[model samples]
Target chain A: MAYSNKVLDHYQHPRNVGSLDKDAADVGTGIVGAPECGDVMKLQIKVDESGRIVDAKFKTYGCGSAIASSSLATEWLKGTTVDEAMAIRNTQIVEELSLPPVKIHCSVLAEDAIKAAIADYQSKQERLREAGAPES
Target chain B: MRHVLLRLIDPFETLGLPATMDLDAATLEARYLELSRTAHPDRNAEVESDAQVAMLARAAAINDAFRTLRDPWTRAQALCERLAPGVVAATAKLSPEFLAGAMELAEAVALAERDAAEALAERIRRALAAILADIRAALTHVDARSAARLLNEARYWQKAGADLRQKLRA
Candidate 1:
């Protein structure tokens, strides 16, 4: 299928295409795979003390549409609150990318990656908070 | 002919074979050839035009069934889907560690020298063999969930292996 201009642009020049310190207390990493097409996507977000995503990155091994979807996701994640990031939907990505019906799953994979990353970040914070809490 | 053309038939049903993972290749081939000969549209040239259309559709469907069943991987996939409808849509939840490792393997393949890529490709092949065995066992037991999961994993390894081989060829 022919990719839209936006999809092609993100694919050719993907933004935030790398990794953060996954072990860091503030960084949340999410790795997801699409079973239909055997596509794998890893999306990570680093939240600051105020819970705003300060940075995002990703590495995807799949088709151009998958890469573009993740790349667009990371771009959206940065500067958004974790809750805001969670609200990001696959439909928005589809609209922005003009992905065909067949490639809609690629956008869904990206949405799952975003939620997974946010969930990881929240769980890490929960653990850190518990560790510093006063004894009952 | 009209009814046959209208309904969707699974590969096993189309080939008039038992829906089992342990299909005999020789038997499958024999069945496919026999079905193809009967389904060939040219043999229906003397029939009405609509009958010819049905014949053409049947011939195409037979070809598709053969293609889907000939490969062990796809055959297993078809069986799993037939046994557990909507299982394919569930998207098997692979572990995060496995996904991470797969990404790293893809990266390694991209950067590896010819010899290293070959080694990695061989490793993937071995892993695929084990997964295929597991899939066969799962299907034998009618464990659609396990079969679906294994098939999903197999697709990743298959793609990786193909990529590595292409790189080596380059």
Candidate 2:
């Protein structure tokens, strides 16, 4: 199936196509895979002191659609609050990328990656708060 | 007709083989040959056009079944689908740790040098063999869920292995 121009564009010149320090307290890392397709994706978000996502990066091993979905996800993640990022749905991605029905799972995987990253970040913060660490 | 339809869809049934992961190559080949002799479309060319068309379809199905049953990976997948319908869809959730490992392997392959890629491919091949053994055991124990999960993991390893091999070739 033919990929949309936007998907092709992101796939060729993916935004933030790398990784962040996963062990950092402020960085949340989400790694996900689609077993059926043998595809894996890693997404990370660095949250600032005010809970705003300051940076996002991703590396995906799959088809162009999967790469495009995560690339677009990182682009959308930056500058959004945690709640705003959580609200980013796969449907919006599908509409934006014009992904075919069969490729819809790629978007779902991207959405899952976003939620997983936020959850990781929140859990890390919770641990720091419990330890009585000074607010950064 | 119902029986024919069932045979057409199920590789084991089509090839008249038991749904076992440890299938014998010679036995499978013999079964294919025996079935092919009767189902070959050429044998139906002297019959009515409608009958010929039906035979052609059956021949195609038998060929498809042979192809699927010949590969251990595809055979196990077919068994999972047969023994536990909808299991593949329902059990699509893989463990996070496994996904992490897969991501790591994918990245490693992406960045490895030729010598490292060759070593990684060898390691992945060994990993695949181990996973296949586990899958076979799972199937033998009637643990369809474990079998399905192992098959899924094997797929990731296979992709990683393929990527490594491709890099080595480059």
Candidate 3:
């Protein structure tokens, strides 16, 4: 099936396509791959001390739907709390992008990236807690 | 059984390999390419219809075998099938712990919103790696019984990995 207009637009010109400082306490990175489709995606987020996401970025090597989903997710994540960000549903992304049934998995990937980035931030906080330092 | 027998008679024998799982993929692929070049239907345009059909069947089998052996998870499954035919009926059972872990991961993915995709993907990736490592270590054992169970577990993890990967891509 042909891609939705929104998905095509995002695929043609993605947004927030960059990286964050890996060494930074607030930065979280996630990478995932699908062997069946031979697709890979990397997502990153920068968060502030109050668990507020300041920025998001992604790099995905896959089909048009996958790229569009990542691009849309990155754009949606800015200036949101980690908790709020984690609550962003795949359904919303799919609806917004008007993705076809076959491409629903692409939206799911975007949701996965959000959780991975938050988990990374949480792990970092846990490490800081163990080290007796202020948590980011 | 018929498929196996037909495969053996028509294509597997031609590839010069036993029905066992220890076949080398690179050798098989190279041989497949060489054979396809010689007997390919495209090259035999003036050949009889029966000859073309036979070539097509052999070519398809070669491709199937090459693909099956190229992937470690599928290769392991095929090995189990060859070592103990019909064992798949009983071996499809997944351990409760594995099932639970997969369910938890699936739930995490389901709850994850668009913004948290990266964090969820990272967690799932780490979990999948650990599962794969366990399966790989289990496969190294020589015992047939244990190896069968391990192979089954490997298959489980392979499916789980695919699911997680889809979620990350979604």
Question: Which portions of model 3 miss their true places by more than 4 Å?
Answer: B1-19, B23-77, B80-170
**What is candidate 2's TM-score for chain B alone?**
0.92
Error of 1 at B126 (Å): 0.7
Every model's TM-score: 0.89, 0.88, 0.53
Ten contiguous residues minimizing lDDT sum, candidate 2 chain A: A127-136
Which candidate order results from sorting by lDDT in descending order? Answer: 2, 1, 3
lDDT of each: 0.85, 0.88, 0.68
Write model 2 residue lDDT over A1-136, tens digit each, in one string.
8999999999899999998998999999998888867899999999999989999999999999999999999999999999999999999999999999999999999999999999999999899899999655
Q: Which lDDT value does model 3 have at A27?
A: 93
For all predictions, the C-alpha RMSD in Å is: 3.6, 3.5, 12.7
Per-candidate iRMSD: 1.0, 1.2, 10.3
Report the poorest 10 consecutive residues by lDDT, candidate 3 chain B.
B2-11
Q: Which window of 10 residues has the lowest lDDT sum in candidate 2 chain B?
A: B1-10
Tens-place lDDT digits, model 2, residues B1-170: 32233333888988888889888999999999999999888776789989888888888889888888888888887887787865655677787788988988888888998667667888898999999899889888888888888888888998888777777777
Q: Please give the lDDT score at residue A95 for candidate 3.
A: 96
Q: Pick the lDDT winner.
A: 2
Clashes in model 2: which pairs?
none
What interface RMSD, in Å and to 1 decimal, does model 1 have?
1.0
At residue B16, candidate 1 shows an lDDT of 91
Off by over 4 Å in 2: A125-136, B1-8
